[model samples]
Target: MSVAEPRRIVLFRHAKADWPQVTDHERPLAERGRKDAAVAGRRLAGTGVPFDLALCSTATRTRETWKLAVHELPQRPKTVYEERVYEASPGELIAVLNETPDDVRNLILVGHNPGIQGLAEVLSGSAEGDARERMTRRGFPAAAFALVSFEGSWKTLEPGVATLLDYWAPSE
Candidate 1:
């Protein structure tokens, strides 16, 4: 928490939603998905983490999840559309994250599953702790998210270094 330190980035996958028949990217949140996202938002808001900014994919489900989750926060965070996130791999996400500006210290990225979970596991150094174990076993359910702390600047990121601060989902 020093002035010289860079801010942390937290990654979240959109909660359970109605998988749309139209297309994968066009899906919207189901009733339960909406409720779960709200609950998760409230829980995240209580953490006292301050996200200076947020980035989300253009997918309807991802967009909706970000809105609902941010609602519980004390202040609104500056947000942007990351077109690349719709089907981004962990490597792609890390690339986008590293390209972010230096002024931003804390950020939230809300996206989809598998990819997000993949990123979390790849970034975390070891798999001994409860968080790693749970991730390894469950593979991140819908609405699942992980708070990771990274060393060095956001522009200089590599895999297997970010520390997992917490992981949560509606089920647990």
Candidate 2:
């Protein structure tokens, strides 16, 4: 039997956003946000994981975060911006992942929180260790990144079925 390759998903929260002068959806990334995005991007790239696709939210800040993060990647992945991701619930985020094409194994989801954070926690389940404890205590902060790996198709993903491979956030 052929070995099944593990599927990986990277959940990233948008970097810091500028103060509100416009609608929430229109808020742009601040200078700090830009720098943070770059740092997070490099960190993600350093993991040596090649992303096959990126599913991003349509909001300006979210979109900008994805653009800046992907800049550090060696290969640019196909990206799709979905309106449903903006202010999405944890279930909604899972739904988005469920819809991904089966051929795309390594996928990234760049959006906001606590949806991102919540999804990370839910997927982590009872997999306890230093990383899980650390993430639990700190919570998923801005520009935080969580890499989860599972052994099946994207459509079959469910809570507590994936392991947290790594978690990181941009330095202050």
lDDT top scorer: 2
Candidate 1 lDDT over 87-172, as tens digits, reads 89999989988887777778898888767888888888743358766766677888887888776777677798777877777774
Instruction: Give the TM-score (vs. native) of candidate 1.
Output: 0.91
lDDT of each: 0.82, 0.88
Pairs clashing in candidate 2? none
After superposition, candidate 2 runs with Cα above 4 Å error: 1-3, 126-129
lDDT of 2 by residue, 1-172 (tens): 1116788889999999998779999999999999999999999999899999999999999999999999999999999999998999889988888888888889899989989999998887655357777677778878998888887777788899888888887666
Clashes of 2: 0
